[model samples]
Target: MTVKPADLLWPASTARLAIRPAVVEDLPRIFEYYRKPEVSEWLASHPADLDAFIERARQPELLACIYVVERGDIHIGDLYMGIRDAWAQKEVQAQAHATQAEIGYVIAPDYAGQGYANEAVAELLRICFEDLGLRRVTAECLAENVASWRVMEKAGMRRETVTRQASLHRSGRWLDGYGYAVLADEWRGSLVS
Candidate 1:
């Protein structure tokens, strides 16, 4: 099945967060932290300014996958889960389309180390494997980002790979990267156990 924002039941909740589709009004709050060097430094790409951020967020495709993470009235962060084709041999390539997802999250620095990232990511995995029926979901981050990889581990995703000098940092240094993933059956089984 093709995964889209409409495929999810909005306001998906966890113990402490409400994960809902991002709206135009939420762009500023997202940009506020996303523009910061500390936050943007880890992201693959970021908007240079608020105008650029707004422009990028307005894209229909991106808006569909972007979700705002809120705690009551506080907008603390954002999440993304982009659906795509998983790898397949030529004969079975058609079966791969939209069968997997790549997820990402960014929590406000103020909310860091408070377990909010872990909580939010767990919800994201549930949304992907349960609501979206995705076969698998994966995430990657620079190896130096201890906090990010820890959240992935806390969410029950296994460390699938660690690549040396696999990514280029904005500061002109090659950085190692870590990839993590979980299959749908594995995720579901974890909940039962």
Candidate 2:
């Protein structure tokens, strides 16, 4: 099944957040945090300017995967969930289509350490497993980014791997990377526990 932005029930809520599809108006608030060096350092790629950010946000493909994270009227950050096919041998490849997704998030600095990331991620996992019917969901971060990995763990995703020097940072240094994942059954089990 092909997943689109419309596939998700918009304004997905956690205790303190409203996660919804990205709109043109939301891009500026998102860019506010993304433009910071501290935040941009952890991301694979970020817009260089407001215009660039808006331009990228306007794309149909990107809008489908990106979601804005908000606290009532405040824009606190953003989340991403990209659906993709899982690995399968030739004979079973069709069964793997859209069976997995990669999730990610960015919280504004002022909102860091407030459990917002954890709450938002837990909801993302719910959407991946319960709503999207994905078999598995995964996320990755630079190993040095302790907070990012911690959120994944808090959301019940297991640490799958730690690859040495797997990512090149904008600072011209190679960084170790950590991967975390959880299967649909595993996520459901986590909820029951």
Task: Give all candidates' CA lDDT scores.
Answer: 0.89, 0.88
Score residue 188 of candidate 2 by CA lDDT: 91
Question: CA shift at 55, candidate 2, in angstroms?
Answer: 1.5
Cα lDDT over the full model 1: 0.89
> What's model 2's overall lDDT?
0.88
CA RMSD, predictions in order = 1.5, 1.5
lDDT, residue 49, candidate 1 = 82
lDDT string, candidate 1, 128-186, tens digits: 87788889999999999999999999899999999999788988999999999999999
Error of 1 at 124 (Å): 1.0
Q: What is the lDDT of residue 185 in candidate 2?
A: 95
For model 2, give the 10-residue run with minimal summed lDDT: 1-10
RMSD of 2: 1.5
Candidate 2 residues 1-193, lDDT tens each? 4555486668999889999988888888888889887798898776688998789778988877888889999998999989889999999999998899999999999888899999999998888888878889999989999999999999999999989997889889999999999999999998889
